[model samples]
Target: MTTATTTAPPVLHLAGISHTYSGQRRRTTVLRDVEYTFERGTFYTILGPSGSGKTTLLSLASGLDTPTRGSIAFNGQDLSHLGLGRYRNKHAATIFQQYNLLTYMTALQNVTTAMEITGAKPATGSRKARALQLLGDIGLDKAMATRNVMQLSGGQQQRVAIARALACDVDILFADEPTGNLDEGTAQGIIDTFSDLAHQQDKCVVVVTHSQRLAAQSDRVLNLRKGKLTEQANTP
Candidate 1:
């Protein structure tokens, strides 16, 4: 008799993903045959120079775009086979360097909007409360939660973006240059928040960053060069 061996499904998987864009004059390949896996409760940082397809890779992993020649799977389900919008809403959330919050909206409003968009089952007030709670968790206070995003500093705005991402309660968080605009101390604080999210909250956190400090804080570091991926050795 032969015993069957089962392999665990990755929380997120990318297999041979490739992407290209065609313009009138030339075609440019952004990602090339990339493959990686992210498990729950782990923080991964993808590091590379500018124009290295880091953001493109994050978009594809988050189901924002379809791969040209490969597959992305979430818990054994193919991303292409699922409803991409619903998949993104339920399984992943993205934070960008720009914060992407409405300038006129309060921090709580920004987070609640994400929760509403994701179809989370909570009353508006409850959602706001949860949003505020998340903001507090990320080191923001209630006063900041009620203030307009434009009134906040850059680091504060980025913290709000992180709170908004967490509001959706998705299994995976995709962040693109989340600390690009902050100072060293503030950036370190943000990295600590991400670490807590992955270790304490059991979330899979993937960040595309160029900062060595941020890479050092992650559970694993993936280096992307000209769209290819390799694991870095010095990750914590």
Candidate 2:
């Protein structure tokens, strides 16, 4: 008789992670024993007030910063053991609040640059096609794709940023205040797009937001206060 073995799903895990900033005479702890597990197909939001270490948590989760203590693992592999730059390029993507696109590059060029950063070797025609497709997926049109980022509005620039983040086919996406600059309606649209990406595409979406609306839309809402996390009940 032949038997089949079942494999566990890949997850992002944080175990007793802690971070401290050392000053000349004192040390400030930014995170304390943070233990959380993030799985695919879920929109997870970390909600916290300013200086509550939410962004720091994102940095650690994305392998942009190392913990002062404990470990962060992705798919059972320790992130500390991996080269962070490569880890970010291959497995994780980030969208910032300011929409960090190259001012000189067109929307398509920005997305194509992201694909190139991931070492994707698509042909020139294919790369442009993929970039345009990504833009469309994020609700931008071909004309918008060809426009320089500087010529776009805030919301439009943010859409291009989202497309760039999606260009590399990353398993995990980290968004920091993704809708901080948008009006309510625009913010709702962006949140909806993130929701679809998480639920439909089966990607792990971690967002750091102070917006209750965004947090409510997530599958799980985690509250970070004074360097600790607690799940919020009654989240939408």
The candidate that wins on lDDT is 1
Worst 10 contiguous positions by lDDT, candidate 1: 119-128
Q: lDDT (CA) for every model shown?
A: 0.89, 0.88
- Per-residue lDDT tens digits for candidate 2, residues 39-123, read 9999999999999999899989998889999898888888867778878989999997778899999999999999988976454
Please report the TM-score between candidate 2 and the true structure. 0.89
Quality of model 2 by C-alpha lDDT: 0.88
Q: Positional deviation of 160 in candidate 1, in angstroms?
A: 1.0
RMSD of 2: 2.8
Off by over 4 Å in 1: 121-125
